[model samples]
Target: MTDLNALEDWAGPLLRKIEPAGRAKLARTLAQQLRKGQQERIKAQRNADGTLYTARRPHKLRDKKGRVKAKAKMFQKLRTASYLKAQGDAKGLAVGFTGRIARIARVHQYGLRDRIAARGPSAQYEARELLGFTVEDQEALKDLVLAHLDL
Candidate 1:
């Protein structure tokens, strides 16, 4: 028979007691890092001038003779460019908005993320069992985490 409780051994007594605090601290650190990181990203990321996306502008119909009925322009922003670089921006090959990768990004205003915790402890927890650690879900957690920890 498999001892389901055996996992507790690995977690140790802290699992029941310290885990919450550790996790809260972790969450707190995560929020602070993410927020600062996002700010840095925004600061570093060049103000996008244009991109391959939807655009809106005033326009006018043209005549066969080449008479302009109206004038207009397009609007767009390439989100890809703003993407955090591999090492310089993110810690490593950043993943899409998910797990720890996302939790890290949650602090960002635009939710832009780096790729640091791709395959580490934070990554493992965020992906494996950080149930409420998604971008959308981390909102309340962010507040709580911030409150719990110094950061």
Candidate 2:
């Protein structure tokens, strides 16, 4: 988690200078950019800290003819904009998983144990940070805010 006090101290003056309409627009743009960056990181199977996510357990399945199916990427559906939403208003912005998918995301996010299926056995999922603020993200936000302000 980021230091709220530090962020407030740093951004408060800049944010106060913008009118309400401009603040809302800035928030919306920031949310979209944050969402885009998150999707890219997820696609690369990387955490916000620049570490690779733990590999999924090998689960080989064979066709009737005995050919092994290729492994699919993780969080394919979860990474989409529909499931991973970006919401922003004059007050603030947020990028996160929405609805029932949030439950599934929580399991993997904290290395929690959960059932594999409706009646399947439980298994431990590794902790993979699905969302976080990174150093690059901070720089991008700073640049974006400066550009928005025409500074």
Candidate 3:
């Protein structure tokens, strides 16, 4: 599990010491980095464990013999809708999809079962680390925080 509290603890003091504008800037930087990470995951279609995301369940567009009639890119809408929001107070950032896309992403991220009218009952998907912080990300966040601190 992600130690988000630990990250908050590490950032709290530094954020408190900076001016509000600086703090917001730092927060935006963090959000940008997080957004980049998420975009990379979508492009790679692999989880943090280096495993490719399970092939998307086949669709119902099949011909007479039960062969697929058409192919569609998986998660295309979800990928396109991914976004980032840096809190104005500089206390937090959100990196994920919004609206309907948000619901779909959560379902996939946790491998939760859901109903798809076109596809029938959905299978449990493999849990994918959609917004995990890598060691490199942590180091970079630390550096960004330190750079904004008064020391």
Candidate 4:
């Protein structure tokens, strides 16, 4: 058999015990850093491909009166296969990453405000992946390294 230890190497030392506190700590750290970079990139830019990436959309709600709801902000939904059926039925928008995805892309709206709310960017991002050195930036490798860490 081809060596799968490389997979283990690609994974951190915590690969064998994803549920343990040590792995959880590393995952949280990595997730935080990853998310931060994405936010900054979106923030520094004005329009996301001229259509307003989810993080740049204007809030779309109004209060009891007609003042544009104070807290009504843009929304995004990142979905996976599990979320597909439910969000689709609700008329939510789904965006695909064109690569390996932990979950399907079912998020179809909103941006920063939604992201800041702790709900995270609403669009289902291709599952955060850690890939081989050779295909690092290929953008379509099916190997998702973060899967073990999160769920």
Candidate 5:
């Protein structure tokens, strides 16, 4: 994950220039934009660095013909705006998974070893950067800030 401290430093001056109400609005806008980008990337199954996510483990169940069943796309519901959220206030903004889903997201985000199911075997999931500051996001942040200032 990109260090947010750096972003805070870079954005500090520009954000300070805005009035409280405008800053709050800008924060909401930024959060929404970032959330949209993240949803797109997750749908594409790409990491923050633009690399393809490690494929999901193959299903164990087989068809009558003995072929393994094709796995469904990963994180379909999890990536939706309901499970994932974008919220902001005067202080700052955040785009992330909310509720219990966050625990599942964290498992994949850090490649942690966890149980596959209750009483099932544990496995190490590969790290998939579910969230991070990408290069494009950095540029977009700059553009958004400049545009907001212009308004």
Candidate 6:
């Protein structure tokens, strides 16, 4: 299980000052902000390290006649499949993507190897760090938390 407690040191004091309902609202808002940051990073093809994702492998876009055809970028489907859901309760709020495509994100994020097709050999993809925390993300989170507390 992911430990959200690590964030307590940062937002705990502010969270404690709010009522239960307000805390839930703040958590939901924070979750949305985090989701937006991740989506932006993926769209920009950048990892948490600020490095560009590996150039997409070229696709075979030629027919037998050597005519060029358009091709989609690698992970295009996965990127478009991104989503964020916030779950709030009296205890706190949890936000995450709940879909099969999230598995693909985890694979790429960790550079894990898996088979592309049945009977095919496993292939390893580069680590993309799609959902990692960045410096900008920290600043954004802080600003968002403060703003929400103000309301």
Task: Tell me the tens digit of each residue's lDDT in model 3 across 1-151.
Answer: 3566888897787678778777778788877776676667767886755568788766678567857666764555555433433333456666666766677678878888777755787666766656556655677778877776744
Candidate achieving higher TM-score, 1 or 3? 3
- Per TM-score, the best of the predicted structures is 2
**Lowest summed lDDT over 10 consecutive residues: which window, candidate 1?**
123-132
Better of 2 and 5 by TM-score: 2
Candidate 3: regions farther than 4 A off: 58-73, 81-88, 118-123
lDDT tens readout by residue for model 2, 1-151: 4554666687779998999989999999989998988999999999988899999887757765868788899998899999999988889999999778999999988999999999999998999989887767776777888899899
Each model's lDDT comes to 0.34, 0.87, 0.67, 0.32, 0.87, 0.71
> Which residue window of length 10 is worst by lDDT in model 5?
57-66
Winner of 2 and 6 under lDDT? 2
When 4 and 5 are scored with TM-score, the better candidate is: 5
The worst-scoring run of ten residues by lDDT in candidate 2 lies at 1-10
List clash counts for every candidate, in order: 5, 0, 0, 22, 0, 0
Tell me the tens digit of each residue's lDDT in model 6 across 20-105.
Answer: 88877777777677777777787788887789988765667787696888865455545442454556654775655567667766
- What TM-score does candidate 4 get on C-alpha atoms? 0.27
lDDT for 69 in candidate 6 is 83
